[model samples]
Target: MRVAVYYPWVYLRSGIERALIEIKRRSRHEIRIYTNHFDPRGTFPELDGMGVTELSRVSVERTYSAVTAAALSIVRTRLDPAEHDAVLVCCDGLGPLLTFANRRKPVVNLCFTPLRATYDEVYRDRLLARGGPARPVKRAAETVFRLVDRMAWRNFDEVICIADTVRRRVADNRLFPESKIHLAYPGVEPRLAVPEGASEPMFLLPGRIMWTKNIELAIDGFRRFLRDAPPALQRFRLHIAGMVDAKSRPYFAQLQELAGGDERIVFETVVSDERMRALYTQAWAVLAPAFNEDFGLTPVEAMAHGRPVLACNRGGLRETVLDGVTGLLVEPEPAAFAAGLRRIAQDADLARQLGAQGPARAAAFTWPRFVQTIDAVLDGAQRRSV
Candidate 1:
């Protein structure tokens, strides 16, 4: 089957782009990507050969004006039904708008979470806390977007979420029926076995450097950990590494400012896959402080590297990181994370135990399994259309 996968933007080596790359490489169907913006230099190099088509020239900006323009472009753009048997939307933001013009073909949504601003109360609260003249305007716009977003959901034959957390969000929001929503966990590449050596007294925070990551929480927690930790753990470092996009540069800068001349807090941007693996291999444990992430790939990736994960007890992290088992899951607060970090740092045996169980658990999520689940969903959609 020929499949056209639509995502709003393909300009970051984040989980969504990585998932698309894995699907294109592993799926049996002929897959082609469609997006509003495609930047070869910024995203995964593998995408260069994936036959990605840009529907319109849209700059990668997170401002309201830019998002509105991109949504309009997607709604107006049409895909020829003859070119593909079905459509798969890599729904993150406005990508579902593509279904407006391509309803002629069966549409399946691989939802990363129904737009966070509209569906996520935590995220909405944060935005509202930054009270401004635009608050009323933002609320009015969201009301309309929510209506349009739910309307677009009517076109999706099935919704495949990355986690049960997201499945519940979609169902609770009434964006799609709970019965039609399926969960397919994303896969992480297995890292080559690194010899068991003493890990550095370092905690790694890895993923796209975005505001929603709540990286400041990690920084604050690390600082708190350092103040009360044993002298031996005082030498511990916090490394923030990941892709930095245009819009997120400000947020990244804020994080740097939050670090405040502390050489212990290092920042590495747009790191190569090889470097990321090295960071994971050297770290004592990985940190995930993102606010209700759809389905965190960093934790699974860390587990694959036999590195324990210290993640917030929210969203998809709960599904992946088992507290006191695979890794510790604490509140998304600096004090809570500081306590969790202290425990992992002080008890080497506990850390080792958690890391030991990681590989086996990570092995359950495979690229082939993810693609096969998607393949079955696509086939089922096609059958219903027939």
Candidate 2:
């Protein structure tokens, strides 16, 4: 069957883009992507040859006007029902608005999470705390958006959540009944066997560089770790690697400032897949500091490389990382992470023990498995429609 997948932006090497690439490569069905923005040079090179259509010229700006414009365009756009057997929406934002115009086919939504600005109380509180004079305006907009978002969700035949964290958020919002929602975890690629050797004294933080990533916590924690760690551990370095988009340049700059010209804290932006894999293999551990991530791919990727993870003990990380087993799960504060780093660094045997169990734990999540689940969901939706 032919499926049209709608996503708002395809400009970053994000988990959503990775999922799209894997689905297209592994699924039996023909998958064509429809998006408001597409930047081949900025995202995965694998997307170059895939079937992708740009719905409109939309800038990836976070300003209210730009966001509102994109939302209007998405809701107004329509797809030809004759061209596709089903519609699959990859939604974290206004991408769900596609349901407003395309309900003729079997519509399935692959939700990462409900919009954090509206549905996530913690995130909404953070926004309001920093909202200044526009707090009232922001609150009003959120109320209106929640109504529209719920309406869009009602049009979908089914909603596939990437993690139970996301499933809970959707269910708690009353956007969809339990029967319409399903859970399908995303997958990671298997890494080649690394020759047994001492890992480099490095902690790698990998993902898109955005405010939501909470990168400052990692940087601050690393600094605190270095201040009192042993001489051998003091030599350890922290590397931050990921895609940096136009909207997140300011956040990236802020992170650089927080690093304060420290040589041990390095920033590498828009790294290649090969380089990313190499980083994972060489590092002593991986860092995941995001607050309540929908379902983090970094921790799983780290585990696939036989590397331990130092992650915030919240959200999907709780599901993926078993504290004191596969990796150390700690509070999001700098002090907590600093202590975690010291513990891993001081005990070589402990680190090795954690890393040894990683590959086996990671083997359960594979691209083939993820694609099979998606294909089955699409097929089921189509059969019900007929």
| lDDT of residue 259 for candidate 2 | 97
Tens digits of per-residue lDDT, candidate 2, 138-236, equal: 988988998899899989998899998888889999989866688888868654322234589999999899888899999999999999887878889
Model 1 stretches with alpha carbons more than 4 Å out = 190-198
Clashing pairs in 1: none
TM for every model, in the order presented, reads: 0.97, 0.97
Worst 10 residues of 1 by lDDT: 189-198
**Residues 103-170 of candidate 1: C-alpha lDDT, one tens digit per residue:** 99899999988888888888888877765888987898899999898888898998999899899988
lDDT of 1: 0.88
Error of 2 at 291 (Å): 1.2
Model 2 / residue 26 / CA error / Å? 0.8
